[model samples]
Target: MPLAGGAVALVVTLTLWLSNMSRVPYEDALPTVGAVLALVGLAVLALRLVAGGWARAGLMSGVAAVYILYLPVAVFAVSPSAWMRGGLLLMGGVAAVLAARRIPREAPGVLAVNRKINLILVPIVIGIAGVVLLRQIDLERHRPAPDQAFAAFDGEASATSPDVWHLIFDRYGNNATLGGAYGYDNSAFLSALRKRGFAVNEEAFSNYQRTGHSVASTLNASYLDRLSSSAQAADWVPIYRSLTSSQALRFFERQGYETVFAGSWWNPTRRSGLADRNINYRAVPELGRLVLGQSAIGFALAQTGLAYGDGRGDQCRRATYKFEQLRELADEGSRKYVFAHFLVPHPPFVLNADGSCRSLAKATASSRRDNYVAQIEYANREALRLIDAILAGPRPAVIVLHSDEGPWPEPFVGDERFLGRDPVAVDWAGLNARQLAEKMGILMAIRHVDGAPAPAPASPINVYPQIINAYFSGKGVEPAPRHYVFESDAALYRFKDVTRELN
Candidate 1:
């Protein structure tokens, strides 16, 4: 019984680990599997102590049968509905229990039968896990490097350099998109930015519809079309490498600028080894936190209102802390390149406009539009405050305020829920203009100490190059031409020149 239970736990762990290896670490699965095995073992032992030999053996067999069937049942189920999957699992469990009852309680060979079952299943499960681990190792070895797509800037540094602040507000929409879609006028935020000398790009759009691709493209100063052919969208290693070890950071490092990173709870931008300094609230490893949040126990606790399994309040506190840290950094007397990624105006909307924690139920139960707009109002006010402090700092600075993507549309309020859906199964043909706009429209503005406002209708990929040309002209690098490209979130590697389509 113990061996069978252990085998079940092993198989489930390996399956989940293999599926999410790109985003989750191998170590995170170990604890979850251990807990499952311990619980099942305890339950089997308790049954053995109280029940007759025949009944105990039958229950053990039934459990083993259910676990064995779970893999195929879960794999073959095509529906996204959780209830459907649960119903299928329950039916399988019922069938297994009934079949176990046919075995005699007094059978002389019952022990032998159970032993043979465990002997057969244990090796198979272990072998499967070993194979999966080997394949994952190979995938890690062959992952692409960021330097392949971007060359190091070979330009001489200017004698005088301004502090550069690149602040990303995840999923923030532009004024027109906000007004048209949510009827929320964003003029106050834009006017505030302009008052602080920011040239708000009213027509700016993200180069990619997702954060990983968008940030990767902008930071590398290149479109991902070339790399997409050779890269796998399912594997996030290449994308993360692009964000952390990009040519952009190396370029700034070469120019005698100290690199400071302020990251959110998201793994990719949470912290970087390349940064000279890091600011983050959560000390827990991101993969571990993610694993715990998605575990069965965590789900149960969340549903029962016993815990904030999603950690929305923690994220809110982290956002507040990050903003405060950025404010402190503005006073430092060094030429620094600050990259702060804030999860604001993004869901698990827990912050009111005044920065106080809102009830998690209110945040979740409210219409997606209402929660998003309120968060946006909060983000806008906080952002202006941060910008004002940075502008009043010791040195002249260049601040680029932007979003990796725009507010998600109906049926997709948060990126987590949106990305969880199978991309291939989505109906791309039915995607309308508003949906596309929601995915593409983003916020972008630049405040340079001594430069004209950036041209309207800017692409994020070109923003840094223009900055380089204006401030570090010795590099002699031409600015990337402004062009709009749209790629389906389903086919992440595919790119379409949608400049004309949107126009």
Candidate 2:
């Protein structure tokens, strides 16, 4: 029985760990592993107390088998509801227990068959785990390095090198996009920004459609295609590294300024070890947390009311925590380059326009368009408050309010289930014109403390370069070319020049 429990624990832990090894650290899997093992151990002990001999042994083995296979069944099975999957597993377990009670205790043939099955199963599980571990290790070893060669501005830092604040609001659409799609007029938000001396770009579009590519290009001041080859397109590790440890942060660090980051719960922007200071609200390790959220055990816990709340509740907590931290930064006296990325107006919409938590039931019941508008309205209110606080601070700051990428459109809302599909096969011609435009259209506005010589560019790629040129060195940075690039959901690293397609 002990051996059976150990085997089940090992197989389940290894499967969960290896599946998420690329995104999360090994240590993060320890808690979930321990919890799973403990649950299985408790179940075995309970069955032993109620039944003796072959009945106990059979029931223990049955529970172990169900636990081990539960994740695959829940994830790959036709049913999407976690509750439905859990109920199915529970029924299977009960059936196994009942059947085990009928087996004869003194049967030599039964004992021999059970012994042989255990021996075979243990070795097979171990071999599968070993293979997965080795493959993950190979993928980690071959991860690509980010491009570090940026045009350095060798100018002295004067009292006029304004404290820069790069504020990114995830999936925020421009006024026109908001109005056209969701019937929400965002001009009030734009007017508020304009009132604060920000040069709002009404016709601005993101250089890339995805967050990883858009942020990577913006911070590096170059496109991902130019920086790295297509070989690293399968994963997001390279792009994540670029966002955290890019030339942009390094540039500010060299200019006698402290780089403080208020990152979101998302892996790419969560916490930057490269920055002088990192602030995030998620207590658990990121990769492990994300992986656990998708697991069968995690689903069971959530369904049984053991969890704090659903994904919507967690999103609200993160968004609120990040925003509060941004508000407090107004009191800091140091010349700091603060980068606060807020995941708002995104999916799992949790907020209403009035700052009250939207009921999870209501949010889920609402249409995607309704949920988006509610969050966007809430974000607008919060953004204005943060902007006011920053502008009222003791020191002058250059604030760039932008979005990593615009809101996803119809038939392609924010779900990533389509990642495995071939990008080349997707019919780009069938994409809706308004939806495509909205996806490409992002919120971009910049406020220079002291008036700048040049206007802010439409593309995020030129944002950092323009800042360096305007304040640090009086030299001119060339404008980004008037072209849009689109990459498919499956192949994020592979680029398609969709400039003419959009036009």
Report the lDDT of model 1 for residue 329. 88
Off by over 4 Å in 2: 1-10, 13-130, 137-142, 147-159, 227-230, 283-287, 294-297, 304-309, 414-433, 451-454, 474-476, 500-503
Check candidate 2 and list the clashing pairs. none
Best-performing candidate as measured by TM-score: 2
Q: Where does model 1 exceed 4 Å of error?
A: 1-13, 22-129, 137-142, 283-286, 294-310, 411-430, 451-457, 474-490
- TM-score per prediction, in order, is 0.74, 0.77
Candidate 1: residue 64 lDDT (0-100): 54
What TM-score does model 1 achieve against the real structure? 0.74
lDDT of 2 by residue, 63-104 (tens): 555554544355447677766776766666666566666655
Evaluate candidate 2 by giving its C-alpha RMSD to the native, one decimal: 5.5
For residues 23-141, could you state the per-residue lDDT of candidate 1 as single tens digits? 65444345655666676667666656644663354357346535443533452356456566445545665766666555446555666666676788779897988888796777666
Residue 397 shift from truth in candidate 1, angstroms: 1.4
